[model samples]
Target: MIWIIIEFLFPALLIALPLTLYKSNRPLMTKFYLRMTASGSARKLYARCMLILILLYHYVYAGGHFGEWGILASTTFCAILFSFRRADRWLTRLHEERKIFFLTAVLVLTTCAVPHLHTVAVTLAFLLLAAMFYPSRNVLSKWTDEENRIRWMNNPKIVSEYYY
Candidate 1:
């Protein structure tokens, strides 16, 4: 009975938590989108293509054999690679701070993929979900700084010339 409930709940939470976080972080995501757009069209197109490829690989090729853990690891690996190449200094800094979180998430997801570690995985996932809502002070400060920068960029005088 409890096992059955947990089996259902774990997958549901895995899907729901990320979606909730994405929705809640819309403003920040929007700012990221704007910054990406401002970077250049070629890079934007490359990013979109890479995203499509990764999704296709995950769903069509890797999903049945390796499950969600494969995607988590691959995505984290990609992010670590991309962080160094990002055009924005602030984004690079943010990614640097998140490297530890990304590593831990990968570790947890890998553990979750193991056959006999279900309980531990569930606990880690819950803890990680909680942590997502309450980021470290450095991350919070950086986010605040980015918001202020965006606000400054949107000033009447600056918006006319720079902002799209």
Candidate 2:
């Protein structure tokens, strides 16, 4: 009984550590977020790589079946296609928020789908989920303001040299 309880609570405890840290240290997290978002292309590349890794994990460890391979291939192809698109220029705040929400949902679903949940698997899933959802309400507001300022400063009609 004790082992079962520990198995279930371990991941939750691991996830809580980061949440508490972020909650207690707002400025530090904001700075981290700014540094992360400074290079837009780098952010996209990191996200794509993480997604591919997650899919690969699902394919390899979860089950090496034909169905899993097909799902992995199709999802990877779609991810590649989306990455190549020039849609980043047109993304609004609302669109970005929706994408974040979608990613969170996907992560949750993927974690829940593991056939045999083990300690390591649960730990990895929770860590990934926590990292993905790190931005708190205060940090997000600051991020939005920073993004808007950058967009305003970088407007083609404003000037040639960048302000920020």
Candidate 3:
């Protein structure tokens, strides 16, 4: 069971982190990528493609755990899609925030209570946390005066400024 979780998680991290990092620090990452040789880019791209292909292969083709794999893929896809939304409305949308917070709290508590399903619970908690934090992340990026680095932090927005 643990190995199953690890197999899913490792591929997810590979796919998610690079994309997030490139979004968060585009100029620097772009420059870095540009400096790499063509062969290097090919190798890196191939590796990432292969990782995703292999993981999806397991999800679609592997036997004996089809239901769990399907659930994992669906939830992961939804989480990734939802992560693109701006969470700035969390301030004025107090009712919505309350519901989200309550659900996240429940997941966290459930993770503590159920050792057998720890990995699934933890993954869900992380997805919820990302949804909560994504919109406010770029707030600090605009505020920072420093060069060569970008800061990210959560600072809620006004009602009119909120993302609808």
lDDT of each: 0.46, 0.43, 0.40
TM-score of each: 0.37, 0.37, 0.31
Q: What is the lDDT of residue 29 in candidate 1?
A: 43
Could you tell which candidate, 1 or 2, scores higher by lDDT? 1
Model 2 has an lDDT value of 0.43
* Candidate 3 lDDT tens digits, 70-105: 445534543443321222233223224668668766
Per-residue alpha-carbon lDDT of candidate 2 for residues 113-150, written as tens digits (9 for 90 to 100) = 76433323443454344344333334335445766547
Q: Against the true structure, whose lDDT is highest?
A: 1
Query: Comparing 1 and 3 by lDDT, which wins?
Result: 1
- Candidate 2 Cα misplacement greater than 4 A, ranges: 1-31, 62-164
Q: What is the C-alpha RMSD of each candidate to the true structure, in Å?
A: 14.8, 10.2, 11.7
Residue-by-residue lDDT tens digits, candidate 1, 1-164: 54455456555766786686442435564454344334445334544444444444444433244444445655554454344244233233333456855776787788778854543454445434433432233433443466645664464233212222
